[model samples]
Target: MSFTLGLIINPFAGLGGSVALKGSDGADTVARALELGAQPRAQLRALTALEALKGLTFRLITWGGDMGELVAREAGFEPEVIGRQQGAVSTAGDTETAAMAMVEAGADLILFAGGDGTARNVCATLGTSCPVLGIPAGVKIHSGVYAITPGAAGEIAAMLIRGELVALDSGEVRDIDEEAFRAGQVRARYYGELLVPSEPRYVQHVKNGAREDEALVLDDIAADFEESMESGVRYIMGSGSTVAAIMDHLGIPNTLLGVDVIEDGELIASDCTARDLLTLTQGCAARIVITPIGGQGHLIGRGNQQLSPELLNRLGRSAFHVVATKTKLKLLAGRPLLIDSGDSAVDQALSGLVAVHTGYRDQVLYRIG
Candidate 1:
């Protein structure tokens, strides 16, 4: 039995990441991102997944233009374009209509590329009628429907099309207020759920917020990090409450959801952009201190896009110091921490066992991929 795969690519997805707009949800934000020289990667990301399905016996169904057909063609698949796109720039309506058309066409799975907004739009149309998967091509992807990486999405899709056993589960579709997000407030709300393919190694878990009980652990980890801080050395602090605790302990103002830079116990830069970090790291000995995303165990690339792959490569693996509460690690249930820095070379280079600071004077070796 040949499986039918529906593809939807949000061309504007992840356009605001390196430029540091927090998200690309609205038309104005997308425009601004382009003005800042943000290039579309959704097509390339979708192509990465489709490359794995090159020889698979599956019928490709998608929309016209950059939504899906273009990417499918580029990836060597002659996709049957069903829905018609509006103008040059696609809108949320296009995503919704394409998804609904895919369902109507009896697609076995709907593979989409975008952030939470795209997920929400597709979920609104398909609901639980079809299984869905995301290619992780966005700035902020708190939705559980996304694969760990684009390659992983392809691998999982291949398994499904090859008649391999894969469990289906309800994946959460979440969206946050973009306005509030730009102002440093994270106000994420659950939109709904979509039936998604579940493969432990391929699919990502939903991001978990900080728990109240982790306060003491954070304090301990902060104290440990503070003690290890060297004078005259720059520290690039990645975003998260865990990293925020380090700044709080030093009485330095920090961006709770943005990357910051510190030098010799002084705030050099707050809420630094990727360009800012790249500029700061030139000829300076800098070390990165980051905490994994709760539940998902992602050390980089989820929320902290400011720490781009170039920055990570410049710093090398030795300059990284991973910190997490015991509770966060426990939530992984033996799953290794993940890293999707948008650079496969960097991702592979950083993969392996790394030490994670759990608490004061405590550490554990965890795998990073």
Candidate 2:
């Protein structure tokens, strides 16, 4: 049986990432991101998923222009335009209207391209009625409705359309206060929930806060890391509590939700941007220390865009040091650690087995791909 799929692309979703504004939450931020040379990838990200569903028997429903129609066409699917925007750019209201139209059109599933804000808009509109999946095209995607990667999103959607997967579950719609986020504070709140396809291997889980037990493990890992720190060497610390523990141990400030830099156990930069990282690491021997997101097993490309693929390649795999608690690793259940650095070559180069520091002088080898 053929299914009807709803597609919505938020053209300005991830505009603020590479430029380091933290999030593209409002019109002003999107405009500023463009001014700072940030290009929209929502359409390109949408295409990655749609390309995977090329031969699937489904009717595409979408909005006109950069919202969805254009991307669906670029992906070789003739989508029915069900809604229209008033001006050259689309807004949150446009997203709401499109989602509502998709529901009225009897869409079996809605596939949207955006981050947390877009997810919240769709949730506000559809609630628990229609199933939804997210293409990871935004800067901050704390929601659980998104697939692990855009390609994974397409694969899961295609399987559902082909009647290969039938189970569905309520995925949390979470968003952070971008204003507070930019000011170095994390204020994540539950927005609502959306019905999502339940495929643990494909769909990503919501990020969880650090636990009390994890804190002790982090301290041990920090002690090990500090002991191994070499003088005059730069360390680019990726965002996470595990990495934060290192900074805490040193009595230096750290960006809990943003990347930072240190040299000889001193803060060099706080809340560094991608460009800042590139400039700081130039002509310097640098190593990147990161921890995977809880439950998702993602070491890069989910929230830490400051560590761009170019930077990863420049540092090489040998320069990477991963730290995670045994509890976090157990959550993976032996699944390979994932990396979606937005560079296929880098992802391939960084794949394979790597050691993860779990405690002082204790480590475990894990595969990343």
Candidate 3:
């Protein structure tokens, strides 16, 4: 199992900051700032934070479109998208709605991007229900909830995901009156505090912040795949990142987006087609190593079209080795992994619970719908 990280990016959070508009709160100010050629940087700031989590495992949940989905995908994450924008332009309402949805989805933490206004919106919706970290992207970052820099926010999130000794404390969310600021007066109001992670370090006797380098779990999965190899038994390596990891561990060439043939830990053929698969596995003891598409959870179809119904029938379920990271599987949120082999009989036979290889000597029972 993996922890769920909720994400929300205020697409227009810092639009007015660069154009000397003070802040981007009202619609008129945003329009004026845009006319002055101010570019939006909130999404880019969020992307920077997400990139630090590369090779780590966590379930990502976010709102559809610019609120979070676009940046999440850009960071190589297949986040579970939820909620809808109620207006043409994303408003504070959207942020509040997204925060509420994150809580309902059982998010262990919510990582948001934007300024003090965005922080206020999230604070109003979530209170202290779950921990949150803020990326500094707005012009007036008076909020204590925000990290000093976007990179710091990402590093803190990576520490939390790695199970480091990080203390959770309440951080104040404060915002100033932009109008008063233009008149040479300062008026800051406290919205409330949110749970945030602070003081990241490692436990005793552990080195490097005690971070386990969870990325090595791929090596474990690959080891398990190698152990399953038999003498002269042909293995049809399928398309997907998980299988690619196995090939990497074996130190062999792999056509990442295509099928391959291997035997005795050596690559026999590269980029095999449907017809090629049937011909190669005929009259031979063969097995397949496959993985589901992240987020969609499609075990078959949706890219592996080469695995036709006839081919699946010939291979049978016993010949299949389903592999995936627990983080990827958990992102499906209990929804069954899908199998669309294009044959009703083949699909039915492939249905029901199946053991998914998650790591070395680790397996989880998941349904193939």
Q: Number of clashing residue pairs in every model? A: 0, 0, 0
Summarize candidate 1's per-residue lDDT along 229-345 as a digit string, tens digits: 998789999888888888899999988888889999999998877889999989999999998898898888887878888899998889999998878888999998888877788
The pairs that clash in candidate 2 are none
Give me the runs in candidate 1 sitting further than 4 Å from their true place. none
Q: List lDDT for all candidates, in order.
A: 0.89, 0.88, 0.77
lDDT of 3: 0.77
Tell me each candidate's RMSD, in Å, in order: 1.3, 1.8, 18.5
Better of 1 and 3 by TM-score: 1
Model 3, position 26: C-alpha lDDT score: 82
Per residue, candidate 2 scores C-alpha lDDT tens digits across 1-369 of: 579999999999888887778899888998898898777878888888897898778888999999998888888888899889877789999999999999999999999999999999999999989999999988888899999888889998899888884689999999999999887777999999999999888888897755755677788999999999999889999888888888899898988888889998789998887889999999999999999988789898877877888899999889989999889999888877888776767888999999999999999999996
Write one digit per residue (lDDT tens) for candidate 3, span 299-369.
Answer: 76433545656778987888889998887777677867776443547878988888899999999999986
Candidate 2 residue 55 Cα shift, in angstroms, is 2.6
Poorest 10 consecutive residues by lDDT, candidate 2: 208-217
Q: Given candidate 3, what's the lDDT at residue 280?
A: 86
TM-score of 2: 0.94
Best by lDDT: 1
